[model samples]
Target: MNPSSPDGHYFSPEPSVASDPRVVDVLLDGVDLQLQSDAGVFSHGQLDEATRIFLDGVPSPPAHGNLLDLGCGYGPIALTLATWSPGARVYAIDVNERACDLTRDNARRAKLDNVHVSTPQQTPADVVFDAIYSNPPIRIGKQALHELLATWLQRLAPTGVCYLVVGKHLGADSIAKWLTSQGLRVDRLSSKQSYRVLEVRRTDREQI
Candidate 1:
């Protein structure tokens, strides 16, 4: 397990929190959701603003296909995807074992059988996703964040798209430029509350 800070390390492999789980309620698409969260994960006290904006900006996923919630801290994005796209297989990948544990229980509580929570290494390398969503871990540092994006972005299907939200103060523009330079099409879907909602697609074909 990667060494972690117990207070709140979304990327922690093994969080040391004493298992004080809390229930959080969030409304999405007019439906109420109760999620289990704890101290060791990201934004455990409430749904972070960036994620709420991401959810508001990205529409319901495709009805049937593979979907990924990268850095799925306690499964908000993953669970939402599972609930919104019942036919799709939603994979929630997180390094923090406690976050994964919370997500698993949350999914079960929600009666969602389509969620698969695991560490990145446990995910099948051969599987590709139709769409991916995240409010990425910006504090993870530029090099590490770039590598994280590259590892999974490469697994996107030819026509796949990724939706992300990053705070402007967190260098959103820099990351967008970097992504474009790497041969992906980057577009700003919205900017609100100092956050940028970015939509990325592979430049697999030349534009006319």
Candidate 2:
């Protein structure tokens, strides 16, 4: 879903496209939200189908703990998690500064104080996530995607879980195999609309 824009890729640190902001109306878990979106970010105008499916399928987040929304675009997943778990601290991380700014603005507009919008490097190094949700930028290429996942997955709490939605055509099964090879436990939670929703956890927690 992260195709190159006229100026640069959506993953670019600073997108070169002119600002074109808009309000996106989204309904998650029966909660209505008006989020600020703009050009140069992923799914600028509306919630993409993959994310819609991912949100609809994932289980309820932890009641209170550190949560992460990786590759957060315009704060849809991050804001939704904040709405769902008001007590949780939601870290919304992205590489695009424009996207990060949009997320911060949207969070402020929604009055969700629990969300922390930042670039990956800006996230506190000592924080461990209780849960992570992502509709990753698979188009970033396999090596980059692998590195990105590895970095964050390592930050998962011992008993933490990461829920991801990847398209079947985009090699969801292969990613599961790769995660398994890395000594993580991967389960296909559901398959809908050619997308695979994966539930991942540390294998060491199996005995617990």
How many clashing residue pairs appear in each of the predictions shown? 0, 0
Return the top candidate by TM-score.
Answer: 2
Which regions of candidate 2 deviate over 4 angstroms? 1-7, 205-208
Q: Model 2: clashing residue pairs?
A: none
lDDT of 2: 0.91
Model 2 residue 129 lDDT score = 96
List, residue by residue over 108-141, the lDDT tens digit for candidate 2.
Answer: 9889999999999999999999999999999889
Per-model TM values vs. the true structure: 0.93, 0.95
Give the Cα-based TM-score of candidate 2 against the true structure.
0.95
lDDT (Cα, tens digit) per residue for candidate 1, span 83-143:
8889999999998888898899999999999999999999998999999998888878899
